[model samples]
Target: MLKIGLIGLGPIGSLHIDNLTSGAVKDAELSCVCDMRKVDNPKIADIPFYSDIDQMIKEGGADAIVIATPSFTHFELAKKCLLAGKNVLVEKPISLCTADAKKLEALAKDCGKICAVMLNQRTTPIYKRIKEMVSSGEIGKVNRVSWNMTNWFRPQIYFDMSAWRGLWKGEAGGVLINQAIHNIDAFAWIFGLPQSLRAWCKFGKYHNIEVEDEVTCYMEYPENMTATFITSSGEHPGSNRFEISGDKAYVVSEDGKLKIHKFVGGSLREFTLDTKYAFGTPETVETVEEFEGKGGQHAEVMNNFVSACLGKSKCDYDASQGVLSLTLANAMLLSSFKNSEIPVPFDDELYAKILAEKQASSELRKEVRKDFILDFKKSFR
Candidate 1:
């Protein structure tokens, strides 16, 4: 059996502990847990707990480590775990910058250890089906993609719950990196990376924070394809609409439903060229699918990790795939910061330097409330 150690006791960390102890994952047991703060829970009353991660590493009980710590600490903690010869499963936005993320990826390869991230949204059935359809060319040659995903509404008290909630030095970014990264990852998973992008970001637009809470980005892909992503954390009753237009079909995913309209005549180019009339249109068929369950979510991801560690199956994905989401978020922010379109695979060093500058200039603040309780399930995408 693969013994898993979990770090951090924050909201997400608590969720991981519950999932591990609830017997949801097969062939794995919670061997130990570590956090800087005092851990007081009956769930882990019989389990080993450490205040220091180094101590946990030295004791050598767990074969794998799950890092659910704050975003800023991901790199160092993951590196330490990897160097200590432990497989790692870290939370999303692997690191603040692409450079550190890439370094972690390379080090994991060198260390010969499994390193994965918690991009659990990929397990959602609707998205999985969409990816399959797109990859199968049910939607042929995507021409345009637009997503207005602003359902992640947050109040001031939400940010006030933690000191590191919205600071660049703490969370690295706001909605783009913190809340919308899963969507960005899902988008990249289905559509792949874009060539260039222009973006606009509004920092602390609706809250008393130091990072972006609203963003609009326009990206250009190869073959004359384009995409638009708009999101905000301050909008209430916001919509989560994603649309894709291709030569043969158009797809819309929203409100836990997917709608596809397939063209009957031929490709749009062919129809346009062959039609003699100026207002000619092609015959189309529409289909809609609704989802009631959220799939396995975090539990599914951990199960995959355990099976991969035991060589039972290939890992669904690892931290190496996490770079694209981070890169996309960084590029959008960098474009807004410079007021210019940034290219894909932008200079990693430049992004790191800019992040360092922001951190250096950051005026960290204290949390307004320490007893605020959070329901992790409510935050699931």
Candidate 2:
């Protein structure tokens, strides 16, 4: 059985604990939990509890570590875990910056450890089906794509709850990084990387934060295909719909329903029966489909991570995959700030330079919540 150590007992971390002990991993146990907050579960009474992550790893006898800390601290925590010869499963976005993500990826390679990210959207069966359909020519050649994800709304209290809420230094980014990242990753999974990206963003549109709340990005691909991503945290009664048009048909997923419009034939003919003197019917027809599943995203990601740890399967949302999504997000931010089209596989140096400039200009301040930082320090000591 694989013994796991969980760091950070936040909501996501607690969810992982349940999954680890809830038969999700047939041969896994939550042998240790390290967090600043004291664990209260009776089941974990016998298990080791340490406020220090490094100390826990050294003495807990764990085979893997799940790092569910804040986004800004991912790099340091993951690096430490990998260096300690432990497999790591980090939450999404990997790191606040692309350079740090790349460095972590390289470090994982050197350590020869399993580094995975929790990009749970890729585990959805509906998205899997759609990917197969598109790749198998069922949708023919994709001509255009669009995703509108304005349903993610966050209140001011959420940002105010922690000091590292919406600023560039702490959260690193706003809707694009924290909220729309799932959709952005889904986009990359459905369609390959775009040739270039251009975006316009409104920083702190509704909230009193220093990061963007609304953004619209334009992506161009080969074969004259294009895509648009529009998202906002300020919209209420919003929409979460994705549409893709191809030569053969168009597919749409909106409000938990999937619809496809496939061309039947050329001529618009009518059929008449010997019944009442009714008019003819159109020849063309359309088909609509939908799917439902019990597994939530969190459960799916946890299961996948467990499978990967057991060598039963490989994770689709590995560290490298997370890097791709993060790079795209950083590109969007760069495009907005530079007021120019940013290319895919973006230059890491350019992003680093941008960050440095922001830091130097005092535009980005390290506004970490004192309590959170103190807790984190205590956990990592």
Pick by lDDT: which candidate is best?
A: 1
Give candidate 1's error at residue 154 in angstroms: 0.7
How high is each candidate's TM-score?
0.97, 0.88
What is the clash count for each candidate, in the order shown?
A: 0, 0
Predictions in order: lDDT: 0.90, 0.80
lDDT of 1 by residue, 90-111 (tens): 9987999999999999999999
RMSD of each: 1.2, 6.4
Task: Give candidate 1's whole-model lDDT.
Answer: 0.90
Best by TM-score: 1
**lDDT, candidate 2, 131-213, per-residue tens:** 88789988777889999999878777667667566877667789999988888888888897899999998999989888899
